[model samples]
Target: MTWNWDQPDWPKFSYKSEALVPLEQQFLLQSGEFVGACKHMGADDQETLKIELISEEAVKTSEIEGKLLNRDSVQSSLRHQLGLGAERPGIDPAERGISEMMVDLYRNFGDSLDDATMFTWHRMLLSGDREIGAIGGYRTHAEPMQVVSGPDYKRSVHFEAPPASRMNDEMTRFIAWFNDTSPGGKTPLPPLTRAGIAHLYFVCIHPFEDGNGRIGRALAEKSLAQNLNRPSLIALAYTIERKRKDYYAALERNNKELEITAWLTYFASTILEAQRNTIARVDFFVAKAKFYETFRDQLNGRQEKVIARMFKEGIDGFKGGLSADNYITIGKTSRATATRDLQDLVEKGALTRTGELRHTRYHLSLAIQSTA
Candidate 1:
């Protein structure tokens, strides 16, 4: 029945320095490259990229916990927070709440970690969920909390957090380590490695009745942002979502041991992969700049919007190229208008058409090959 926190050496988490060195180097290199790439972007483009990255993180982090949020709603909320635009429809209280938390974390990345901050984040995360009842700070109930899978008849517990009675004390210790910047303190740990440890520690603490996973992930991101001294361009949540099986397995495997070398290795590797994925986005930004310069005046507003979205989102933005239906949706034009606009793009050499008649799809022409 003993969990990781029950170990005699609990809270003294350690990792293999040799294993983490290369991973750490790769992460720092990729992160620096992303930052350098971002520096070349204009202010507006930088803001757009920020919105895209944060929105993806917000949506994917919730998705990991089986909560599917509307990406548009989340994006709209974020845009409103960043003062980029007015709020859009479909932004429920939950969406707004998540947006506020995300924006706060990014904007105040260097704020000292404290109990008040943690409680505020928890309250915001569950603000309008009546079923979850009052967001009365952390869980104080003595009931056991376990992360389980499957039906009750055949449920399996993947991890068990420390008892509720131990949460406050545990968190105090964690916050001290988090805020300590002295060289002799926890600063010897690489920033990214420290971030990984913070993630595992917070999740193990499981302080809240709900939303612990999301909050933990946010804390991890905050750690990275504070360390990097900038808003994060890399979204580790996206990589975790893509490799969810390994993500959960890493957690479960480490939950049973005091030494967290495996978890640290997995965490570093995931971050490195996330940063590598972001490099493609950096290239896309460069490509987009060239694309706009070459064809900005050739396309109408609708075509410009669609092409910009395709360029920013890359391959995952649309599958099999842009279709009339998708164009209609994204461009907010009638079917006939969308078709006409698409045809105009084709004629202008901004798009290339495939298939025949109703089956046709439009892809960016040689003038702008998609980098996503």
Candidate 2:
């Protein structure tokens, strides 16, 4: 017999609870850290802080964007969360993989991403593996569902299975309810808060055999962008990855309990923590730009143009970092010329290239002092 989690029907999750105190404290501490990082630092050019900000910026954007999927992207996402560097994949496939999917989904619907889109994103995350789900095109599965804690590790926990042949119907109903019931399903809860809940709920549904976790997170991002009314931003997969074990436990707690008060509260709090971090990252870049601008008179024409493009596009253009193509476009020069200009900037400490060849992307080099 299966050992199910506790499900108490006594109290419905609302506003008040001593359970939320720890969450509040946790969020408060995170908010303070965010403020400290963004607010006036003694050293105007805090290179270490700036790098942390850069990595964070990338991580948050990816998370919000719902673009991260796969081992490399997952690792990169975790790396960003852990504040660790080195020992990583060459590139973040999530950005390249999921950003377009998200942007297009928002554009088509004219307001928020729909449930179908969420399922499609799930399919995409699984790279169109038909066996993953029946009707494999965003429709929920047509058969009994299976759960797995780990792919290779068969000994891992498997649970939260939905009844046979009803996964699709029940989930469809839930999606409809979620979209229509809210005062502003897209905006009722804060984006990060909403993200936490969505992630948990989708996982609870357990619609697919493989890629459920990744897809559930993706759905969280799509809803999050809609909720925040900012579809262009990246996902906070990094934040989730940082607290992987905690995140899993939170989910476990959420699934076990019938009432969502504690689950929602904790989820909302983590989201707030993630939110503070993301906003602070934006502030950090603005601060970095301002500090770097003090020596603006030293910059040449092309350098100025690159900076202008950067200012115009903000970080999404290359906040996770810019690409050789982005440099080519931003510099408005030929490939060879763009290459040279990028090289010049690299030497001048304006940019740093990560990965090799076509995988190359140039990002603000926070480490090196900018040359006039």
Candidate 3:
């Protein structure tokens, strides 16, 4: 059960570069399309999108690590950090911390990766976390860093990272390799290949005592952004969160070997899926603008409030498709008014109604469907 870190080749990873060519091309095309699609978005839409995408990555990446954060709080923290919205008091520490890290990542996507940068991100990510013994630095404990599952009595060691004693050397090599493979470096790699390999290589090192997974995903995004010469505008963690099981399976399967074509292939496909998801989301933003333009003058205040609440839930609309009772609650109106307003929305083609009577539900007739 030796890991790749224990092999003679050690950090020198090998892969079938030719196999990733098609995916690389697809990623390039979709990235261009994604950027072009974003240009069509209105100023307000673009701002909403920037907050939405970054907060979504923060929330989803945390969720992947079994940390359930309030999405709204995270979004609020991000808005304040990005200077797009007013800073509200009593923000949760976890929310504020991750938001700061994400804002830093987004703002400095093209900066070189170094120990100072990694430490800054680490400190920002675990700002208020009290459980980790070593904050903002590499792990220094004597015990092994084993990624295990199941209860203590029947635990399974899925993967074990290099010991803390090798932290300085391992991290130095990792950083050098990361920079050397960047867009204009000594051994430049393509977008998806560099991103995929960067993610796997960093996670394998497992440099930090905590926040490795989140930081690893951030490195993947940064790699893409560097190659593309801008923020990649892809919801990588969002897409990976949906396919979490497959994501873990891919990493686990490749942990024992260095020829990581399978891992790269999986990651490339995931990047493509993420690109399509982001493009659809951008399209939805465009559709939303058009929707409001058409109905902005048509809806009353109550109807507008209900619609805004639904939009806040994101591309899926309201969770249960906005029932009459839900609308009444959101609109703060009586049953009759709720019914009338809902009917008006449907009649004007702003919403599509389904079910009937007590089982009735209404959904936005937006042009885009769920990315799932």
> Which candidate leads the pack in TM-score?
3
Candidate 2 per-residue lDDT over residues 297-318, each given as its tens digit = 7666777788666754433445
The 0-to-1 C-alpha lDDT of every candidate, in the order given, reads 0.80, 0.53, 0.90
**Candidate 1 pairs with clashing backbones:** none
The clash count for each model shown is 0, 14, 0
Off by over 4 Å in 1: 133-136, 181-186, 300-315, 323-349, 352-362, 365-372
If scored against the real structure, what TM-score would every candidate get?
0.86, 0.53, 0.95
Model 2 accuracy (lDDT, Cα) = 0.53
Write candidate 3's Cα lDDT for 1-372 as tens digits.
899999999877899889999999999888888888888877887988988888888999999999889888998999888887886777788889899999998899998889999998899889899899988899999899989999999999999999999999999998999999998899999999999989998998898889999999999999999999988768899999998999999999999998999999999999999999888888787888889998978999999999999888777677778899999899999999998999899999999999988989999888864353
> Candidate 1, residue 69: CA error in Å?
2.3
Error of 2 at 70 (Å): 10
